[model samples]
Target chain A: MTPVAPLMLLLLRVTSPCDTGTRVVLVPFERLALPSADARELEEATRRAVAAMPDACLESREDTLARLRGSGDALAACGDAECRSAQASALGASKLVRGVALGVGGKRSVALTVTDARGTEARAQFEAPATAPGEADARAKKALEQVWSPRTTARATREPQGSRMLPKVLWGAGGAALLAGVGFGLASRSTESKLSKNGGECATAGESFAACFSSQLRKGRNQARTSNVLLGVGALLGAGGAVSFIWELP
Target chain B: MPLPLRRTLTLGVLLLASSAASAGPAQVHYALIVASNTGTEKSQAPLNYADDDGARYYELFAPRSREVVLLSVLDAETQALHPGLAAKTRPPTRPAMEAALTRLNARMAEDRVKGDVPVLTFVFVGHGKRGAAGEGAVSLLDGPLTRTDLYARVIAPSKASFLQLIVDACDSYFFVHSRGALPVGPAYAEAVKGLLSDRALARYPQVGVVLSTSSERESHEWSAIRSGVFSHLVRSALSGAGDVNGDGKVDYAELRAFVAAASQGIDDVRGQPDVFIQPPAQDRAFALTDLKDVSSLGYLLVPTGLSGRLWVEDARGIRLVELHKERERPLVVSLPVGKGYYLRSRGREATFSITRASEVVEAGGLPWHDVSVASRGAAQDAMRDKLFSVPFGPRFYQGYMASLGIPQPVDEAEADAALVP
Candidate 1:
């Protein structure tokens, strides 16, 4: 018993239960006063570092870029956090990481910003000087570690399961649907009002009202048709939001 | 024979004899635990924990005792103290209790025939009062049990070699002294200690008595301790914290000293419990309990380093064991420990196991309930609600328990010896 006591005690130490469930997407880092190759190298190195993190699942850069189209240049200017957040939600990511490198010649000052579903933003800035030809990867990795080291990784990746943004997505889409419906309703009302005001003009005899009356009627019909489509879509979306609310927990 | 072999044989024999004295087939324990929350109609408030306390006693004692009887109108949600006696639970009427005693008498007679010493313990966890005629009477479901009746019908007829009686209630000092119910006054408290040297109770040499009140003040209840203050102190003392000699056994004297020391630190005078124990008039300490007697217990090792008060409850939230532990005096519980045992210390709680006898379950290794992010208000409210559920609770700490013979709080270091918090 005495000989095996240490072995037995060692076996009893507790292990961590599970991961924090934070998925991150690193949008390509913007290059400033650096060659395209250097920027690409930096982004690739940082992506690898993030992918190596045991607690984070890195979203594919390609898919992120494709989804974030027109939300400003993905690398050059990542735009406001709301745009980046929307892109993250649209890309099915719980967290977004954007980086920008600023410096002339070889050395660069790189700033990395990570945002979560709860609108929480964490930024890390470090100097990543250009080293030997193959040393770029090592320097990039070292800079990333110094700024966002594994020692502090546990605190950074909270249980951001994208729960915060879920309600917003559901309600936002629902409200958008309703707004389209209201616009269509107003268009229908306007067309009806114009037709009523032009009632005598269309009814007048031999005033070449055939083409004009038909045209007015056609315009009203188009407006009414578009209004109906918008209203129908809006109603379906609102109903969808209600159904979602009844289905999933907050 | 060689000297070493002869000495070894002698030591082995002593061990066998010691085991025989406490357990080994030569002895049997029979307990009649009466936990009644409802007293006679004249009583002020019905006790909330009386029935539960009785159940807790059963949980603690029934497993090791040869035979046990519980008489109470148990709540529907009341958990069974032990599996075997759940079906045998009966109401707390005097006739039914008498019947249970009759059956126990027969069993004791059989044990006597078998040449076994029956260690009989009678526990009353309920209310008590002094009648208008000036006699101490324990309130029953039907009526008051007078002091004379207790001796005439119960104690005098007892056939066991040793008798242990524990009464946790108000005005209980009159049990055997033939004294009338004592009232609350500044002077009476001083005179109550005079009973410490009384010859009348001293004559009962064989009977060990633990009474909760020495004067009119109560045997109160405290939610922090969970059990009635008097009973909880006794139970905690028996759980090994009372072993002042560093020996693993707690006799009646040790328990008395421990209870006195522990209850002395209570801040409110009302919260002080006036405890009285009848010391044996002979040489040998009446070893009330052996902490190592885990033959029927789920042994819990509260390992070294952990200090402060700790409590355990079952899955049904029935409190099982509570003890104030210190480093030099680590506590090991014989309560039925297993999967559902919720261990609480310093307001933090966790679940632990004794699934296997070979396993030495470390107390600190268990998965604890996360209270770091939980609201302090909600936690406090929950404790308040739980405490409030027991009747006569406010009366417990509002000067109900304070009486003569109850000591004032000592320094913090001395206070740590007892269950102050």
Candidate 2:
């Protein structure tokens, strides 16, 4: 064999095992006195829906039953979420799907529950006329799709690039303004210290000392005012940025 | 056994005994809540609801605390409004406060001697200002209680394992930390360094602080709630609504997030109050209130599937807790069990009752009915419509924690494990 052929073969072998997406097992739907055929149809529809998920691989009913039999778990007895989750973990599956199918009045109703290994569950219900098994299948598929839809898609659509970047821009501006305010504040403090060190020498000394002191006082006042203004603006901007950033988070 | 092995076991037992001794006895909470409407200067406008706020705080903490002291001079109007509360209060003067502090210190010392750890909660709700030298002080009936006076009198002589200081006033940030030329947020480490450098509070490593406004802005009182807005929110938070993670404890970070989320929808910039919170440097998880210690309050469960901004109003029209909820995570807010409360949304309200302590009233089970618009003034309506409009849930809490770089107080794995049940 060529060198490239062996490399490609090795790559394929490495990735084939990892390509088996999240393992999902659909347990038989419990029938509340409903016809077994109808219950089987609803279960088949749900299996199709679960298999249709892009990142999910549905375990075959035969394989799931064999695994349960091997584990000494009766297929009809595993009803609650806890039991289903345990069964799914035993079968090396990450997700478990189960439901109850009942005939209410003239309508066939099904309530499905999907439980992951972490025990986070999502539930949905669908109802259709008892005579129309095809309608019931469609409704079950729709309900299963609704229940299995990922929540992250909604969150991803809530934030856009421009809105996400605005907070960062505001934060940058706020930091710059705060730095400038600190500089001015330090200068003002230095001027005040120098004035204090003079110790009223301007009052007893010549006109030069008095003029110098007055100029220093005016400069310090201006610097302090500017610093306060900048600091206030920076604080407002920073707070606005923080609030906006948090508000934009999905 | 050999002699060496026997000595090692004896040493280990002695070490365990000493550690247990250092842990001390069960902590008993003591509260000194002070409120003053009048300021040090005559020109300052008299507030109408400071005394009411103080009374509300006293009612909330008295049932849970070993002892609670209310320092306020209730006028005829306030006394008539809050009947029998005046008897429990003293004048909000310096001498009165000093004498109260002396008595409390003595009682705390006695408790320590009796092998009980004492925790002192100091709450001040009133007017405050910055002096010419940039020192912050809260006004009392006699005069301003300066920062130096507070450190020397309150922090220095306190015989408590932990001291919690809650202040709601103008420019209250400087009351705890000195303002330098460059203004910066008081992170826990920086605040600890400042406290240590001052040497005034050097011995107190278990001091926590919560302030209303971080800057020189004045915190406004809303007539809609008949109390100072910040104080009202703080009261709600401490009453157990601030326990965001359902951990039965309200930490400083949770309190800050609660206040921020509750006030995020205020339309006017001036009406929004900035919250400053710092837990003790030694313990970031230091809870401001433990719900298990409280007996007078019952919890209202806003369970999964009820989503939006909602507020609970008493029969007397006192709006207590306002929160925005998400559909996934559930929340439980503690309210006084004696009164009937209405959970109000924008156009609907559902009445609920908690007839016994620790009763959990499910809001989702209540029947919601349409509510007609009441003809209040424009300002009141504006304030009512704008508050607590933003939803607070896992998303907001995650964003807040990430932005502040605060470590998650609850382990994700543990939370998930707990959720499974």
Candidate 3:
């Protein structure tokens, strides 16, 4: 039987449902003036980015920045300056995210910046289409995906460990023990059959003393019965363990 | 007494009387054009009130029948094409319409000279069918104006000694009541005739009269005859035929004769003009002129005098309170039964009754009688006699509505939102 071990338990924790480790925050467009190749292309890029990070959680909030900036107004008084400051603060979120979308250009531009909020320099940037139609939605999705990778990868890795491993190990050990018990019980039955077949000649020589024979028969039968009981107990224990593990699932 | 002293004393007495009369009661001209029961399927017929010449002439005329403060009542809901009837999206009929009437009325009352006022006219246009067995005569849209409803709502509060009514519609004569027994019919007759009788005429310091397109038993045309009857006659008169003195402009007396001859299915034209007083220079006459032809005095008088008064009435009516003008004196009276209704001497009050028949409660708070313009948008329309201001741009409404989070009908909100921002 496999022994319950701490190393295995630690591995299970890493793969547990509760340990989806990373988080992300999306920042609003800082510069209204930006050049995008085309609105449609920009939008497509944004959609692709978000779609790529299916497991990521994206949160874009105006109020959070409003409160931080000490103004109830959504569009802050300093226009462009306010936008930049708000975007910066949003990117520097507690949750680790890849980057922030920094809007730039007069007509349209997808010079969006995706930087590690933790180790980012001021105004980290990326290049794409400028002034593309339908770019706004696409860009939003793109920005969301770019910032959500850490959390998504962590969640993907954690899924199988919690759902698959523990139940299989318990059932496999119990099944092996039950099989060994059944084989031992069958071997005892075979030995008793051979002795009985030797009969009268075998009884005079030494194989058939009544007391000894009775004791030997009783011992063999008892061993066989014990093996049968062990097999039943192991099977029951395996089933029960499997059920308990399933019930404990997060 | 010597002859010289007696003559001198008589002249002095006459001078004193003239001076005293000048400082007496204040008088103003008021007129109304109530177009209801016109059997056009919609809430109102489109541009039918305007003359064929492009200018809305009927809205400016109709005071010649008898002069006074004019109050025009148009059935906007029934006249305006609703969603199911037409594909066009029209304006909502509510406070905006009532507000226009009150504004006109108040304006007239404020800028009038003090003296004997002329007759007040209420012209109604729409489908008019005779009364049912127990249900009084009704308009095409189910709830028609009753005779009693017209008097208390229009005549009494307007303070004009004369009440002249011209109903332009098929079978408009059905509104006229001569019965001496029924509660509503007799009351309507008495209130209207009271303005004409030597007694009711004497009670007022002015003249009063009520006229109809047809007599009690006749029917008129809905399209040409009733629709353009008022404007056609006025336009002809204004075009110089009624200018008896050949001044290229028709006066009150001349226009009156013109309308008398021009009206189709003519029934009865009644008036109780004052026989005692000599005619004043402007014996309360109104004429229609083109809005754009300023050089020709080209202003079509869209139902005169009720704009300002109507505005006040609208505000008061919505609140279900009597309008009391700070500048005008209250005309209070005691009913034979129960406590009589008192006209508020301040604030604005409308004297129209909104009846929920099933509930058996008649509320005199809304603009029961109003005018609708077919050509002009609601804000600029001068249908019946009510003058409506031009509508502010749609952007203005979009911005206003956005602030309140109410969805606007126009797609211009995107552009309009920029303005508010």
Best by TM-score: 2
Candidate 3 per-residue lDDT, tens place, B1-421, comes to 9743553354345334433544554233244443332333344343343212111222233212212122223334322411122121112122322343355445545434434433344444444444454222324233455555444444445544444444444333334443333344312432433333333223333332223333222122223122333433443444333333212233344444434333312222321110111111223343221111111011111010112221211211211111111111111100111111222212433243212110111121122333432453532222222211111122323443365364533321222112111
TM-score head-to-head 1 vs 3, winner: 1
As a whole number from 0 to 100, the lDDT of residue B289 in candidate 3 is: 17
Scored against the true structure, residue A163 in model 2 reaches a CA lDDT of 50
Per-residue lDDT over B194-293 for candidate 1, one digit per residue giving the tens place of the 0 to 100 score: 6544535565666888887734333376544346867876776665556544334667766766665555445445556776676455523676766533
Q: How far is B50's C-alpha from truth in model 3 (Å)?
A: 9.2
DockQ value for model 3? 0.00
> Could you tell me every candidate's TM-score relative to the true structure?
0.51, 0.58, 0.26
Residue runs of model 3 more than 4 Å from their true location after superposition: A1-250, B1-32, B36-101, B112-121, B129-142, B159-164, B170-177, B181-212, B215-219, B222-231, B245-256, B259-421
Predicted candidate 2 versus true structure: per-residue lDDT over A99-178, tens digit per residue: 65543222345666676665445666676554565776677777777667444223333432445687898888898889
Q: In what order do the candidates fall by TM-score, top score first?
A: 2, 1, 3
Error of 1 at B395 (Å): 32
Model 2 off-target regions past 4 Å?
A1-250, B1-24, B184-203, B214-219, B409-412, B415-421
> How does candidate 3 score on lDDT?
0.34
User: How high is the TM-score of chain A in each model?
Assistant: 0.43, 0.50, 0.36
Find the 10 residues in a row with the least total lDDT in model 1 chain A.
Answer: A70-79
Query: What value does the lDDT take at residue B287 in candidate 1?
Result: 67
